[model samples]
Target chain A: MDRATTETKLINGYQHEFPLVPRPFQRIGESLGMDEDEVLALLRDLQDRGALARIGAVVSPRTIGTSTLAAMTVPPDRLEDVAALVSAFPEVNHNYEREHDINLWFVVAAPSENDVATVLHNIERRTGLEVIGLPMLDSYHIDLGFRLPCG
Target chain B: MNRIAPSPAIDDLDRRIVKATQSGLPLVPRPYHALAETLGVTPEQIMDRMRRLLAKGIIRRIGAVPNHYRLGYTANGMSVWDVDDAAVAETGAAMGQLDFVSHCYHRPRQLPIWPYNLFAMVHGRSREEVEAKVKKIAALLGDREDGHDILYSTRILKKTGLRLVD
Candidate 1:
């Protein structure tokens, strides 16, 4: 197969149900008609090129610990500073600037609910902005839905 | 996943395994064996633990997580809907069934200032595509869709997976 086709197959085919055996890359290599080293190299290259985050497990949120989607409205001028402050917290994982009155949005994952609360409270105290905590009451999707389009 | 049950059953070994592989699995020929050596456990034990984690839904899936940005999915929108509280479960489930809706959650509605209870993350190559997908969600919601807004991510300030501390 060509390089493009090989990459497309590697990414699209193994997004889910990746081989669970001890030699998973070898298993994947067998399926993709490549050697174990080839599969590993391709994956490493993808990671280096910023195409692949990692060949790992996507853990379910709030399963082991607690997490919440929190948002804050930061002044446009202070958005960068506030975002830096929010992102500085190790508990804060995902942070984004959305186009809304409540512009600063983030996800805080901690060992416990109290830890999550503390992280949010610290953000509130530091940024001096009220943080709206929106914990997932119920999830409707079946896992992080199949993403990444086949090109 | 549909049932987001809080499983308080995860133990120390499980957390260790999670910490070891949360960022990404080893890219070696024998990844499990590598994990086993590092965690001071047998390869069989590591594999067994991973299998159980998978069955228990603790590990959603073990695979490649692609970077959507690199794949040209530039427009990321968080579509929030103020639907009838009573009908939220039904509508949210239906919205999640769509191939385009990656994440759908029914969260609490902060009165007055914030009223959206249903949140679905939609991604597209452009704003128009994302808006069109959001329109489909609106159609699905029908009368239950009291109000809605799409919060397009202007910038990705930070994006990283969960990191458990010792």
Candidate 2:
């Protein structure tokens, strides 16, 4: 696809969504004055071009139960082994090695605070690395949505 | 491919609106009106501010949060890729476009052992599905020899909004 076509499709995909109904994509197509297949095709093309991610639900961690941000300082040599060990669990949502001494940071979510504690304890025991738990004490604002251009 | 620019920052009132709407807004037909009431502002004002926020990129999106496990999306993984410094952002933006990928970003790579710089979150109904997606991503990036790890979440401790103090 050419630059103009790619940009147009990207903007449309980002701005348009299927209405909440059976065959919602058809409704979206109606609004865009395009066929349902065409809308679906554009969505697939946008996904292929890396202009949009998955169209799925984003859930709240607190409402579900509990979740926390945890970190550890793994030795350079043992980083991979320790990361693999930590990644073995299913509760970790996302993990990264920040540019800090306390490098390895990961988020854990569970059905309850107690469950999170259990997971943390398991990681400590299994990895033999001290786990520092930073459970969110307060929440200010959390929204992942962002519009494209600033006007 | 040209890089996507960083989003613009939030203004004061925009911050206030966001600070109010962070924890899931009240589920109602007139949710925006309710929010306006809480802020002692008109519904129109709230709507306008939100429109501006969206345009300015202060909030990436406003949508529903599905219970993944309840929906049978039980197996999820965070696949971090060790892309070169020059390609991290481009690769990340590309990865973020995947339908199954819930979240993606670029982070500094740690030395010695930790080298992965790109992170992508993939969700699926089963472990096999998640693994398959990761494998496809690895191939797409042409980083067959790159180091990566799939960290499955074991527990959820605390999930909430980031407080922006003005």
How closely does chain A match the true chain A in each prediction, as TM-score? 0.94, 0.80
What residue runs in model 1 are displaced by over 4 Å at the alpha carbon? none
DockQ, candidate 1, comes to 0.78
> What's each prediction's TM-score?
0.97, 0.54
lDDT of 2 by residue, A61-140 (tens): 34334677778987878877787777667677566654455667777777567888999999999888888775543222
Candidate achieving the largest lDDT: 1
A1-106, model 1: which lDDT tens digit per residue?
9887888888888988888788998898999999999989999999999988888888898888889999998989999899999998888889999999999999
DockQ of each: 0.78, 0.05
lDDT of 1 by residue, B1-166 (tens): 3767875598889989999998888888888899999999999998888899989989888888988888788898999999888898899889988999888999998877799999999999999999999998888778888889999998888988766754
Q: Once all C-alphas are superposed, what RMSD does model 1 give against the true structure?
A: 1.3
Clashes of each: 0, 31
lDDT of model 2 at residue A37? 72
Tell me, by DockQ, which candidate is best: 1
lDDT tens string, model 2, B7-55? 2444567656766775545433346667778888887787677666555
